[model samples]
Structure formats: C-alpha cells, structure tokens
Target chain A: MLITFGAIAIFFAVIIVVLQLSGIKDRDFTDYAVGGRSFGARYQAMSFLNTWYPGAMFTAFGGMAASAGVISFYVLSYSLLTVVLMYLMAKPVWIWGKTFNLRTQPDLLALRFGSRHIRTIAAVVGIISGVPWLVLGMQALGTLFQHMSLGTLSFAEAVMLGVAVIALRQVWTVRMGMRGVVISDMAQGIVAYIIGSAVLIGLIVWMVLARGISFDALDQKMFAIPSVGSAEGPLYLFSLILTGAIGGWCWPYIFVRLFTADGVESLKKSAALAVPLSLIFGVALLIFGMLGSQVPGVSAHPNDVWFIVSKEAGGLWLLGLAGVIVLAASMGHTDGNIQATGAQIANDLVGNYWQLGERQLIVIAKLGMLALTILSSWLACLELPALFSLAVLAYQGIIQLAVPQFLGIFWKRGNKYGAIAGMVVGFVVAVVLELGYPGYLPWAYGLTSGAVALVVNLTIYVAMAYLIPQSQAERRRVEELFDLIEGKRSAAAVSKGVREPA
Target chain B: MSDDGKTNPNNHAAWIIGWFILDAVVALAPPIYWAFDRNRTAILGLPAVVTYFVAVAVFITASIVAAYLAEARSGKAG
Candidate 1:
C-alpha cells in the first residue's frame, strides 16, 4: 500500500511539473477556457478519451456488467456512435468557435440564437445537470482509495483522503486552466488507458488461460442479451443508447472539446482516433468485469471484482498498480468536470450577465474551481450511491440539451424560444419520470424515462420551431453563419484544386 | 457517379444520408440480437453476442476512418 501510494504521489508530482513547465499563460478567458484552440491531433484525441472514459466505467459500470450481464454492452455501441456524431459536427462547431472566439457551450447557443436569455438558461441547465455527475465522479474516488488502502482506512476516511488528493490536484487545474488540463490529460490518459488497459488485457488472458474459464462457462444470465419485451429489453437498451449517444457531447466538459481542436480536420482525426481507443478500453474493461464474475465473492460485490481478481491473480503489487490506474482515470474526469463547470459558471452565468473582463473572468473561473472542489468534496464525504446510478440520471437531464444544441447547430429554423422551451420541458419530464418511475416510463414498458423525455422534448422543439419562426434579422444572421461555413468549405476545396499535384 | 461528373449537392446529401443509414443499421443490429438471440452460437469461444459486438466495433471503426479519409480527399479536391 505504501509503495502504491508513493508511486501515485510521484505520478502526480510529474504531472504538476509538466503543467508548470507548459507555462500556461492564459492571457484571456478564451485561453483559459480552450487552451487558445491550439492542441493538435494526439493531445486532443487523448484528452477526449481521458474525459470520456471516466473512472466509474471501470468500477460502477463494470460492476453492473458483472452482475447484470450483457445489457451493459450498450455503452460500447452508443460510445462509437457518439464519435460518429462528433465527426459530423466537427467542421461546423470548429468553424463557429474559431469565428466567434466562443469559450463555452452556452457561447455557441448565444451565437446561434443571438440571445442572452438563451445563453443564461443553457448555462443554468449545464450547471444543474453537470454538478451531480461531477460530485458523483469525485465520490467514485472513495472506492479507489478504500481498495488501495487494503481496509486500513474506513470508507469515510478513504473518501476524505480521496477528496484531499483531488483538492491538491486542483491547484494545477486552477493555475493553468484548459492548457494545464489538456497537457495533464495526455499524461494521465496514457497511464489510465495505455498502462491500465494493458493490465486489464493481462488479467483477461490470465482468466481465460490460467484459470481455464471459457467465455461460455459463465452464468446463463451472462450469455443472454435481454430483449425489449423482456425486463432489460429493447426500450431499456434503446433509452440507454439513445440518451448516451445524443447526450454524449451535451456534457459541458465534452461539448467544450469542440473548441479545443486546432482545426476541423484535426477534430475529425481525433474522433477517428478516440473511437477505437474508447472501444478498446470500454470493451476490455467490461470483459474483465464479466470474466471476474467467475471469481468467488465478486458476483456479490461486483464493484470490487477488478481489485479482487487482481489481488487473486497477481497479489498486492498488481492490485496496487490497478488502483493507481483507476485513480488516474477518475481524477482525470473529476478535474475536467471542475475546470469546465467552473469556467461555465464564471464565464457564461456570471460574466455574461455582469459584464466582466477577461482578467476578472479568469479569476472567477479559478475561484469557481476552488469552490466547486470544496462543495463536491463535501458531497463525496456523504456516502452516495454508486456513480453509475447518478450518472444515468445526469445523462437523462443533460441529453435535453440535444434538442437545443444539436438541432440549433444543424437546423437554422430552431429559435431560442424552442431551445429554451425544449430544454426545460425535457429536463422536467426526465426528472419527474426518473424520480416517479425509476427505470421504465409509466405505461411504456421498457422505454427509459430519458427516452420518453427526449421524445416529448423533440416534439415540443419541432412544434415550437415551426410555430415560432426566426425573425428576419435572426434568419439573416443564421444564413450568414452558414455562409461562413460554406466559405470555409469552398476555400479548402479551391486550395486542393489549385495546388500543384505532387 | 451522378449525371454530373463532379460530386453534386445531392450526392453530398446522399453520402450523409447513407452514413446515417449505415450507422442506424449497425447500431440497431446488436440490440435486435439481444431482443431475440437465445445464445445458441459462439464465435471463437466467445458468445455470439460478444462476437457481434467485436464485428460491429470493427465495422464502425473502419467506417469512421474511411469517412475521415474521404473528407480529407474532398478537402484536397475542388
């Protein structure tokens, strides 16, 4: 345990040094929000992966898969589809961000609708839907810390310890903003994904060969993929996938990635790269959990299967290594949440309304991160349910942004009224249905509450869009925006055609 | 190719439509399997469902790469 904790300390020290050396001169709020939109393919790809594959994927979701069986694999499909969505959106989002110097998701909404109220409402929704997941993510660290301490620390003590460590890490996040976050993400991603994935593969191979557990040798539930007619059937799976794919980028941390890539082309390449890596890690870790079901006591405490199996197979050293990897991944996600939500609070909700300058905004953003850290840590100290459960609710609420964000980007007919209305209706419906009827919608067996809310949300959005047409000025502005997009496309095309053939 | 040798707006729209069609079909297939399959088959020692997942993952990955390359090619062309 000592050696493992020491290694983690050193790893964090190295990351801090690298961030400090990056000399993140975030002169303006734009630089703080998006690293001046200067990251290349590798940095962008890894950063995206690190943020997307949160620690709970290993602990909570993996445990769920271990216990609940094949239905959990829906994440794999939705995740990849989300990447495809990213590829399609990359060009327009990048063009807009670059053109307007937009720093956050609400900034894009404001640009598209030309309304401060839309931006404010979007910012409010972003924070409300985003904070729970952020708190839940911080709470996941309690599990990691407890496992690493080998029962020496109680769960509460472990949670506090995890909170302290994260607070310490936030110092760098506060200092450097997005530049620090992106650079540190690269290092942490390699550790969590590359090194951690290698450990998972090793364990799976060990399970199959050494333990001689055939893939089909598992429980019958493990083999069956539930139908929509069944309990975990179509509606359930569909809801999971639908919410996941549509809402994937709606998370402020993920949506903000649209502004981080150096170019549309770079963004496209990053999507291409990120999908495979996400699949590799997600599928591999889930498999490890599935195989882990064979080990005694794992099916009972499925969340601990990773550590349990690791300790069984390779003893204390490997378990410690696995702990560190999970820690790195979890912290990577937590830091992103803090930085992004903090920036949103400072820039969109406050700065937009208060008319703050860049310097003041940066200060507020850093302070926002600090305040967020303390609040979420306090939340973590209170024992919450597994992060996955909270995350599902978060997904339900955040996906409401899809009607406003995704549609507003692609369809010019969508007005701020529709965007704001759709988001409120969708979010309220989701929360009500989720709280009232937990899994499936009332009367609609198998349909997830999230999916139900989305259907209502989209219907309202479309109805409102057609009912409330954009004003002549709004229509003209939208046309101008699309023209800018076309201009970029034409420029790229002309450059290609006119250049001498090599 | 269309009546015009150059890629027309219709063709571009068709490509996008085709991409979505493929995406939906691919994404929906696994769930359909989950809805119906009784786990009778195994591919390379893993359950058929898992095999289907690997296959779709590969297909989607190839499609993404191809799409990017095509975009890159289009950028290079007029």
Candidate 2:
C-alpha cells in the first residue's frame, strides 16, 4: 500500500513541478487556448495520445479484451484510421484555425458556415457529448485508487480520494489553460504509454515463458471475432471502426489539438508519429489483457485484470507503477477535456452572445473548467452503473458532428442551414436510437445507431446543399477561404522551386 | 493539375482515398480476416486472428509513413 501510494504521490509531485517550471502564464486568449500555435510534432503527438486513450484503456478497454475476445481489436483498427484522418485534415484545419484565430471545433464550424447559431449549436452538442466522458475519466480514477489502496481503502473511500486528487489537479488546469495541459500531457504520456508499454511487454514475456501460457492452452473462444455469419452480424466491426475513425476528430478536445501545432507540417508529422506508437501500445496492452485472463481472479473481475496481473507478475512495486501509469493517463485526459470544454463554453457559447475581451474570456473559461470539474467529480462519486453506458452513447451522439465538420471543410456548398439542420437532426436520431436499441440495431443489420443516423444525416446535408443556395457574398467568402488554402500552397511550392508562379 | 497551373487543392486525395480503401479491405473484408478467424493455429505463440490484426496494424503504420514520405517528396507536406 505504501509503495503504491508513494509512487503515485511522487509522480504527481514531479508533474506539478514540471508544469510550474514550463511557465503556465498565457499572454492572451490565443496563448491560453492553443499555446500561441507554437508546439512541434512531438508535443502534438503526445497530446493526442493523452486525450485519445483515457485511463479507461487500462480498465474498461482492457477489460473488454479480457472478457470479449478479438472484437476489441476494433480499437486498433479505428485508431490507425483516426491518424489517417488527422493527416488528411491537417492542412485545412490548421490553416483556417491560424487564420481565423479559431480556438474550438465549433469556432471552426462558425467560421466555415459564417453563422453564430451554428457555433452555438455545435458548442452545445460538443459540451453535452463531452461531459459523460469526463465523468467516465473520473470513475476510471476511482478504480485506479481502489486498486492502489491494496485493501487499505474501501471503494467509496477510494472514490472520494480519486475525485479529490483530480479536482486538485484542475487548479493548475484552470490557471495554465491549454499550454499547461499540453506540456503535462508530454510528461504524463511518456509515463503512461512509453513506460506502460515496457511494463506490458515485460508482463507478456513473463506470462508466456515462465507460466507456459500460450494460445493453445487458453479457451479457443478467446480467438473468435465477429464475422459476417456470426450473431453480431457482418457490419458490427465495420460500424465500430467507421465511427471511431470519423468521430474521433469530432471531439472538441481532440479536434483542438490540431490548432496547437506550429504548422500543417507539424501536424502531418504528428499524425505519422502517432501511428506506430498507438499500434505498439494498443497491441501490447490488449495482448496483456488477453493473456492475463487466465490468471486467477481475473475472470471474475476483468476490469481489475491490469492491476491483478501486475501484482501477480511483479509484486507490489509493479502494481505501484501500474497505478501511476493509469493515474497519469487519467489526469492528462481529464485536463485536456476540461480545458477544451471550458474554451468552447467561453469562446463559442458565451462569447458568441456577448462582446467579451480576451481577458474576460480567459476568466470565463477558467470558471467553466471549475464548474465542469465539480460536476464530473460529483457524478463520479455517485458510482452509477449506467455512466459507462452513457459514455458509449455520447460516442454515438458526438459522431453526428462528423458530417458537418467534414463537408464544411472539404466542400463549400454546405450552407449554415444545412450544417445546423443535419447536426440537430442527426444528434436527435442517434440519441433516440441509442436509448431505444442500445448497442446494436437488429433492423439495421448490426449497424450501430450512430451509423444509421449518419446515413440519414449525410442525405439531408447533400440534399440541402443543392436545395439552398448561398448568397453572393457568402459564396465569395467561401471561395476566398478555399483560395487562401490553395494560394498558400502554391506560394510555398513556388518558393521551394517545386513549381513556377501562376 | 499542378503541371497545368490549376494547382489541385487536394493533390493528396488519391493517397488518402487509396489507403483508406485498402485499410477497410484489410481490416473488415470477410475474405481476409475469415481465413485466420479460427484458433487452429498459433503464430508467435498468439492466436492466428490476433497475430493477423497485429500485422494489419503494422501495415497501416507503414502505409502512413509511406504517404508522409511521398507527400514530402512532392513538396506538399506543408
């Protein structure tokens, strides 16, 4: 118990010290929201990893692999596709963000559609979908604390401890803003992913060689994946992969990472860099979970497989390290979500209504962060069994933003009415279907509610694009935005002697 | 388009679309994954299905790196 608690305490102390030395003071709202758009490839990559894989990667996701078999590989598939999307979208997103001083995903939407109403609607959807994940992050911390206590603390006591620690971390998050969140993500991400991968590899080696555990010895059911003929139906895995790949960037927190990069090249490099890291870490972690399922006590409590296996393999010290890794991951995820949500609330929701200065916006954003932390912590303490289900539903709802986001950036004909209509209608359909059908839709041939809604959403968006024409001024503005991107690329090519001036 | 001075805004669209289609086929296609879905074989001490997915991940990573290099070579990485 002492070893585990001490390790976590030392980890927190080092992170706080690193953050303080990194200079958390922001010169203005841009610096506060995006670190003045000055980060390089590595920081952007780590920040994405930190936000993308929450501490639940160890608990819930690992648990899924332990209990559910090869279906969990969907995460790996979608993660690779997500990075591909990042690389593809980096140019327009970064260029527009820098040009318009856009600070949130909704801010980009507003800029693309030229409507405050679109901004408000997107912001509301982003916040509503975002809050559940924040709660889940807090609950993940609760699990980490419970295991770290080593029977010294009850679950309820651990819940409070977890909530309190995360709440305390928000003090710095509120003060230093996105810059602080990104820097700490660097430190925390190294601990959680780099060192965490080493630990996973070590555990796998020990389990395989020492314990003589191999695929042949385990239950054959563990190897089965959902297929065309299976009860899960053909499209189950496809739907999951599609949603994760597209919906990933729709998250305000993850989308905002694009703006933190210094240039499109930095984001491109970050996308490339993230692919291998995600593959290695994700594969190793899930492999460990699968192998650890055979360990005593793991089958009954699969969510604790990470902690149980670490303790069995390497004793107290390894368990301590495991706890620290999960804590690091959870802290980074929670901090980023809080910062991004706060920025959206301040810059998109509130600032859209009233004329506010940069200083006032920063103040409002900090207050928003505080409110979100308190709300998520309180929800975490409730220990609701339905919270995880709500988080899954949030994924369904969040994906509704994808159509508008993709079309708005890639195609200029998508008017504000179409964007708003598609998002509102798609979000409603997702929520209704998710609540009615739960995980998968039988009538839709195993497609998820989100995927079904997306089809309808895209149809409406495309139809509206043709049905409603933009005003001449709106058309010119949209044309100029596209021209800005092309003009910049052509100038860069000419300067590099790759092409002649037009 | 670049040679013609039109400067196609989505010069990399072919790369993105091509890889995306390939990935979907590799990951979700019934013909490919179904071949290894069974646990009759263990490669590298892992179930064949698991090993196949890991290989798929590696393939995707390598593809992204290839695309990045190609973009850089074309001077469109910015």
Query: What TM-score would every model get versus the actual structure?
Result: 0.92, 0.94
Best by TM-score: 2
Write model 1 residue lDDT over A204-286, tens digit each, in one string.
Answer: 99998889866666777776665645665455666677678888888889889888878776887887777778878878887
**In model 1, which runs have C-alpha deviations exceeding 4 angstroms?**
A384-391, A488-502, B1-17, B29-31, B76-78
Mark the 10 consecutive residues where model 2 chain A has the least summed lDDT: A493-502
Model 1's i-RMS, to one decimal, reads 7.2
Tens digits of per-residue lDDT for model 2, A1-502: 8899999999999999998998777899999998889898899999999989999999988998888877788898888888888887888888777766788898888878878788888889889888888987887787899899887888888888999999999999999999999999999999999999999999999999898876666677777766667776667777888898899999999999998999887888888888889998999988888888888899999999999999999999999999999999999999999999999889988998899999999999999999999898898889588887888888898899999999988888988778888888998899899999998887776799999999988988998889999878777767767766775333323222111111
Query: What CA root-mean-square deviation does each model show from the true structure?
Result: 5.7, 4.6
lDDT of 1: 0.78
Best by DockQ: 2
Model 2: per-residue lDDT, tens digit, B1-78?
012112436567586668867876787676676677665576775667888889888888888888887776787777
